[model samples]
Target chain A: MMRRYLVGLILIGLAFALFPLLRQAGVAEAPGPLASAYLENSADDFGAANVVTAIVVSYRGFDTLGEVAVLFAATAGVGTLLTRRRLGKAVPPPGRQGGTEVLETASRLLAGLLIMFGAYIFIHGHLTPGGGFQGGVVVAVALLLGLLAKPDAQVSHRVMTTLESLSGAVYVGLGLLGIVLAGGFLDPRALPLGVVGQLFSAGSIPLIYSMIGLKVGAELSGIIDALKGDRS
Target chain B: MMLEIAIIVAGVLMVGIAIATILTRSLLVSVIMSGGVSLLASLVFLLMGAPDVAMTEAVIGSGLTTVVFLYALSRAKQPDDEDAAALASPPGDDTDGGQP
Candidate 1:
């Protein structure tokens, strides 16, 4: 009786909370002044046709740096918690042989395509709707798929750690280069801004975003590897 | 007009799925329903002209989160020494085994 009443109360409260948001649904509004300015100048200023990419990688990159740090910390925490030192060799592999034949075959075929798609997303991030984070997730998903397929394949922790460290260092180094050679930290203008829509046009935005993609991919793979537990 | 109706239907379905996710006693069902909620939300986002957000929600929210939860569930220990129950039950309940 108590539980039912509590649930009812919570539902009522949620309804009340969502009512105002519901009222605003389907109502279109013009962009605010800040948005208008960003839209107007981002292409010219950042040499990136995708304004969101400009903002994420250059206009407000410190916040992105912090977000990457947070992801790194989370990966580190998961690794520390689930590794062989902490958890003994009690839990065995759920699948003794591997994934089913169909799964293994399908993932084997899809993995290459998935990786290529992820690379394309991050590389074209400066000109398109997607960016490093989404691309990184796709890459991590590919790694996860491969793990699901093979189950006993050796994932080199050394390689993952090295890639993660190198990418993170490159991101920060580029930020420092921005401060030294351009307007501020992570300024896309650190290098020459070429034509707005070209591949090499965004002046290090693509480079920085690629680093971010690699870093995020490696970090997420580390977390997944940790969770896979004592496969060795 | 059609878009608005589609969005409304998606929103209502999300609410229904959310309720189902909470009300389910089985953890595996709950986790899957949670993923369903994300999948619906991604559709809603795509309708709302935010494909980037929709992709993120679909991949991370619906895809990776489900896999991670299943891993954690598989790692969790059972109460007593019927080790087969843990392995046999498929992480939630092969035969309604979230019981005392």
Candidate 2:
């Protein structure tokens, strides 16, 4: 207890000491160089009204690929760690008797809306605040709710793994197409840059983000399944 | 001024929750309180105008993590219960406090 208190106090003091430094950092009222550049060039170059989507899917596309790879590796690692042999007897299955009727009905009712919302978020990512990662997580939450409502319900491993691999392959293929047809890899300009502020205007950005959303959603659902030990 | 006060209050509440999480004996309670801390921190993030990050933190940190912790806790308790059952059953079988 004493050590914890001491550590807490030290952390508080460190935070206080850093506060002034943060304030003195001369926070910019406008976007930084990279942000400003993206903002200026997004419409002309990528035909995306949302500068953030342009940056994420085109300007810094390689970084996003790396992020996806990291997530994939983490999911694989968790799957290995929680293998049935390592876990011994399965952890007695959650909600063995099934959740209450109210829970089941509510989740069933909400699941479709949640999925639609997630789709909307990722589909309109190039024009909205959300993107692949955020929308993917929302989709995962919907699946999680289904799991909670019906523990015995099985999410087909084959389907999830297939979706994961297929999305990843398509994402890579899109990048290669960019190299062949456009300036460089993951170039949104590979396709026709339609009118700005339209759904299909961002060339391949929305497509790529949609693929990313599917890939992320599949990977996260796989991880949840592995953790839940629902090999059946 | 009102926003500043709100931020300060949230910060204080987060700190208090952190302390409470550390001090709590019940692992489940601690997990829940840590979720509370995430909730408060996300509020602060929203106040600071990072709605994206705030949403992520609230959903992933406070929501999913808490559920995961509870699942893990339930799994962990089983082994201890089995160990206790094994210990108790042997004593009853021995009938004389295992003096045989």
Candidate 3:
């Protein structure tokens, strides 16, 4: 009522005040200093056509590993919060009988293709717009579709957990390998940089991104399973 | 120019959706509208040339969050429905409940 209106008015006034200041700061027409350097040397440094990928999977690989750990922690937290012992027969709610036949058929038909596409995205991350996180989410979406189509179907928790653990371990191992073979930890130059703009050209960037993709996909699937709960 | 116009339109729509989400009484509707806001924001991000962020926003913000919210809403509603059913039943049914 009155308070809402006053708050809205204050927000509007603040926006108005900030608008001129924002306009006074000219929009960037060129890359900044750091970006310019990255752009200039990304090809030679990482052999990655996608500069963003080079920066994320090579230059800032440690930070990306931390991000993965954060996601793993969040997924674990969600599972812990949602854990409950099974009491009785797990009944499907009324009127949700595994979706319509078309949905079931479509999901079954599309799941494999979606997974392949996700793999492609992450594998070609050093040469394309998508990377591990994006591809991982796409993979999760594919799994989610399967879950929606078959409400009673269960993703194998043991397999997913194993994949998550293995991928995380491999990512760390690769980082350590970088230290042993190259300049420092997580350095992509540990492996020979292949031809530029090719799929296998970005040294260890593709491998690291692939591991990240698998780990993220497995973690998200685990979270989904935790949310679905054990009906057995 | 067309891209700028599209971005502006999406931005305005996002603002409207945000307001509607806040004002809506229904939790489900609010959840879905927030997803819509995420979607529009993703579009805005794409226009701004950040495909990576835009994709993340579209997938995680809109897709996963919506699914999680719906699951939570269903879980929250179940207890209320069970409580109502229990309340509707006769109090004398408590005699057999001690078997648990």
Candidate 4:
């Protein structure tokens, strides 16, 4: 065990030592377009308070869509794995059913607050540090709390699927519109730029992020529901 | 220079935690230590100027992965020393010579 520990430590130490050397080697005389554009054009063009959101929505919109799909697939996979069929013929586990008033009340309060906060984040994504992904995750966290605190609470699976699918379709449709109307897939300039610093500014960026937020939230909630709903 | 120091510290901590996790017999301790490894990796990614990757690592790697692991562990049955009797039993045998 001691020898294994020493070996692991040595390997990690070497990697740590080498990272700086790698950084130095990679530092070029001219700045790459990615780094320069990230610094210069992210906020101005996208009208997003967070540069990260701008990148996710505009620069890598397709990748973000794929990510949402992956999350949905994972949720479905987990749901399939944990269902009654996999557990085989057996007496059901006791004490896994029923709901308590205390838990229900707590979940109600927390879930409501989280949903509100998530909506706020989604709406203000263009003007704030939060965006669709972050807000959507927050919404999912709320749903998870509901699953934990209220055993009897059932997430409407159909509703979740519909919402997720609809949001994704809308996002893609908007992207296609941009490609058709403008020259690029996710060109913010495709839509009318309302005002520079206003909530409505940055044409397609806000719409894309809003769709993302909704899709993410719905997918995550669906995952949590599928994982925890078996016993209840 | 500051980033370098931070990376070194995170790396050392990650290594130490990994060692502790491997040496420990307790599944619970190992899970927590594995979280430390991911957290350190997230910090390293942040230092390397990839905030997007760092955010993903911190959230999914440390947060969701740990919860999922602990939940699975909680669902599993604990093994005890019924060793020889169980192993020596015939393939078709259903009985173990132990009291319930």
- Candidate 4 deviant stretches above 4 angstroms: A1-31, A88-92, A96-100, A229-232, B1-8, B39-58, B75-100
- The model with the greatest TM-score is 1
State the lDDT at A61 in candidate 1: 91
Give the per-residue lDDT digits (tens) of candidate 2, residues A156-217.
88888998999999999999999999999999888999999888788899889989999998
- Sorted by TM-score (best first), the order is 1, 3, 2, 4
Deviation in angstroms for A183 in model 4? 2.5
Q: Which pairs clash inside model 4? A: none
Estimate every model's Cα lDDT from 0 to 1. 0.84, 0.82, 0.84, 0.73
Tens-place lDDT per residue, model 3, B1-100, is 8988999999999999999988876777788999999999999999989887888899899999899887765544433232244444332232333222
Q: What is the TM-score of chain A in candidate 2?
A: 0.89
* Interface RMSD list for the candidates: 9.6, 11.0, 6.5, 9.3
**Comparison by lDDT, 2 against 4, better one:** 2
Q: How accurate is candidate 2 locally (lDDT)?
A: 0.82
TM-score of chain A of each: 0.89, 0.89, 0.88, 0.80
For candidate 4, lDDT tens digit of each residue in B1-100? 9998999899999988999977877777778789889989999998977665675677667766676675554443322232234443232122222212
Report the C-alpha displacement of residue B79, candidate 2, in angstroms. Answer: 9.8
Error of 4 at A105 (Å): 0.8
Native interface contact recovery, all models: 0.29, 0.10, 0.31, 0.02
lDDT of 1 by residue, A23-77 (tens): 9774658877988998899988989998888888888899899999999999999
The sequence of per-residue lDDT tens digits that candidate 3 reaches over residues A107-213 is: 98899899999999899899988899889988887888898788888787788889999999999999999999999999988899999988778789999999999
Candidate 2 wrong stretches, greater than 4 Å: A1-20, A91-96, A100-106, B1-5, B78-100
